[model samples]
Target: MKILWIDDEIDLLKPFIYLLQQEGYEVETATSGEDGVELARREVFDLIFLDEIMPGVDGLEVLRKIKNENSQQIVVMVTKSEEEDLMKKAYGSWVDDYITKPFSFNQLLSVLNRTLKRRSIISEQMAEEYATQFRTFSEPADYLEWVDYYKSIVSWDLRLLDYGSNDLKVLQKEKKHEANAGFAKYIENNYRDFLNGKGPTLSNNLFAYAVLPVLKEGPVHFVLFDSMRLDQYYKLSNSLREFFEINTEFYYSILPTATPYSRNSLFSGLLPLEILQKFPQYWSFEEKGQNRFEKELFAELLKKHNLRIKYSYYKLSSIQDIERSINSIVNDKADIVITVINFFDLLLHSIPGRGDMKGVLDDERVLLNLLGYWFPLSPIFEIFKRLSKKQRRIILTTDHGFIRVRKPTIIYGGRSISPNLRYKYGPALRVDNKTALLLNNPGDISLPYEDPSVRFAIAKEDYYFIYPTKPTEYEKEFKFTFQHGGISMEEMILPYAIMNPR
Candidate 1:
């Protein structure tokens, strides 16, 4: 570890430097705050020791400059003056540690040792905890449900990564990627089984199994937000307690996690093929524009069931539409209101197209932070707050989750192939059989067949389908980008929650 010490009386600190050296730390000295700031700008240090009283560019100023340059660097403030106000001011400026003028060399060494040692201990603990759980998680038979197991493991890994243990975080991330790869294989083996009713409840049956049972108590507003990840839902659930008591559940999203398929299937309580066959005009597979009109299909489903006890369907893809939905909640006649908020999907799509958004969400941690910041103030919450004052219930859910795609598998097909990163549908579609969930017969999975020769293939884990044309260019552009509509735990396992106002 390297330590940068900035004090006007640097010569007096030689004994302390000798102690730190004995403790196996490299020490660098700067006589003035100005020099210290300049050195900080040029080089990276594990920690900085800055004097509180310096001639040119005082210690407080230097601390501010250092923090502004690199907020993560640990800074300790050393001051000769024992004024309480000075200590308070120094703390306010975000100093990691404070030392008085008459402090012993042992005390200084103790502070440095303790700070660095705490980080080391945390790293070790994280590694040990993950290692212990890793063994149990890796057992083949432990995972009865692929989606739930994959989510549990990813959630643990994500939490470990947030603990900021550098070495352990790297290990956990690799484990997560490995788990995702295995999950992809599991999906390849079992997705068809699930879709064919040989496995568990899937996207089309999510509402029937999860939401309908909860609705027996009272009105349930099944709000299916588009592109909501499990982690994002977990974060948002914390803030919901103030207004409602929430019961959480999870279900698998069908292939093509996009709005037109997964979401439409979700609201209509039917698969894409069923919807297309039942109401052909309402289903538009080739349309690329926003599917705002798809909410009507949900209304149609309710009507078909003869359970028309008053309901409304709203799709909010913009701020204006969100406001409209919020205002619509004032009408208390509707027993259930299904609102599909598309902000996360919009944000995901915008990241690659907008430079500022790309910069902000470049890192997964930053992306999670952005979701946390946006969720509490979202229009959905505004609508929830309004509805909480009424005699009703809210059921929050999503069509699918998203995964940050890293590996691209090259797939070849005819020109008729639908160009979706997570899945493809066409005749003669070629992909690694092990890497995809091949539906050679679409009818078995309740999916539409475009032609007699047509078939659909969904990417089973973190792998996204990349066309052979301009392979390198497309791979470079799409790698590490968030995508969905396939079979990973994140993309398939969705939140189905029942909440009543507190």
Candidate 2:
């Protein structure tokens, strides 16, 4: 492979060039941007490392000219500046990859492998690394171990998507499925103990554990993206990292991981049954009013903690709503501001008609691609930029996450049962015990219901509950759609983080 190293200080790169030459790669050097662009135009090279700063024409200009001439030319920017604006400029010029200055020869070779030999070399490396990491995998022994295991799986899931083979993707998906099965079994056995205060920080206490300590430091801007998965948070963090220094940790959502139950628990700092019993007037399970009282519940939480500080709340479903509310949220004289963005939840619910839903069922990477396409163009990008300037402390989290349902488990329930596909609650609920957790007493898990005979059945793994009637037809309709309120790592293990503006 031929590589062109374009740097104003070309002599300093001779060691790297020599290392590449020793590895049987042709190395060419250009001392100026004009010379580099001319060299790139004259001969086709496998990779071009263009320095960011040059004497006559800067890196951005050279990048534009080279790209204008041959749009397919692979240009990797070598830069010393870590400024956001400079990186954005390079990206705007369509640079393929980047390497910061003061990097070693191995780092340059890694970038070369990533840019030129990504499919063949990097994929093999990732597969070997993943195999080595999980060769002796065992079911997590406790909640803390489960958190670590889940994080490693999420990390591999993202890494494999970037630099692993198709066979490796399949293998990782199988491993994730196995992990989910074990996670569901763990929850089935110890969930009640968790409710009784024996496990990690849960939904009802997440706000206290994640926010109050930060509140002691300063005012907080709490942003909640409803129904966001851990992997989605990891994707969003790249954008968030530019504005804030983030510290992320994982917590567990309560049983029936839906907005009404888990989100209310988050704000009110009380279990669902406790919410229903203590604040019946504010609690509602109706679709439109499910989380209508979040502000009230949050206020109740603050008061329960004996705090009389000012606070503001905004719940936005559309981009226009968020755009309009930003000024008010930023300007409000509140010690804490809470904004709940429901667009992600709306996106998940609206994607059943999309052609890629079936692909999502077969390969989870499809959903990641969908998120990747949407996030860059999403309004949250602008919102984050706006808030980052004024807000010093930020708390980011979600109520729960959705899992793409691959298997439709037959469940028997009446029309009065809640229509969520992942969990059902009503009188005389019957489902395959292997696929779901059947709770005759909802109070066992602190889940609320009006009637004494009301039972809850939460689907596990990739299973979604379907009524016995018209089972086949319903299965086709809801098969690959994302749903929550179930027992899976995606839904239960959630991302909680604190961010300080940089």
Computed on alpha carbons, the lDDT of every model, listed in order, comes to: 0.74, 0.83
Instruction: Report the C-alpha lDDT of model 2 over 1-502, residue by residue, as the tens digit.
Output: 7888899999988888888899999989999987887676556577899999888899998888667544456789999988999889899988988999899888988888888864466567777888888888878999999999989988887776646678988888899899999999999999989988999899999978889999878788888999999988887675467578989988999989988889999999999989999999987767687788889999999999998899999999877786788778777768898989995754543354776555655666656555544554466666777777876588899999988889999988777897889988899899999999999998888887888999999999999987788999999998877788999999999988888888
lDDT of 1 by residue, 1-502 (tens): 8999999999988998998899888999999987887676555577889988889789998887666444446788988887889988988877888778788988888888787776667567767877787767643432245556666665665555334567777776787677777766766667667776776667777767876676666776767777888877766675566578888877777777777778778777888889879987777767574365566776776676677567677666787777765777546466666666786855454344466677555676656555544555566677777777884688888888888887888888899888788888889888887677777787777787768688888886678888888999999999888888787668876777888888
Best by lDDT: 2
Worst 10 residues of 2 by lDDT: 343-352
Model 1 lowest lDDT segment of ten? 138-147
Clashes of each: 1, 0
Give me candidate 2's TM-score against the actual structure.
0.79
Model 2, residue 220: C-alpha shift (Å): 0.7
**CA lDDT for candidate 1:** 0.74
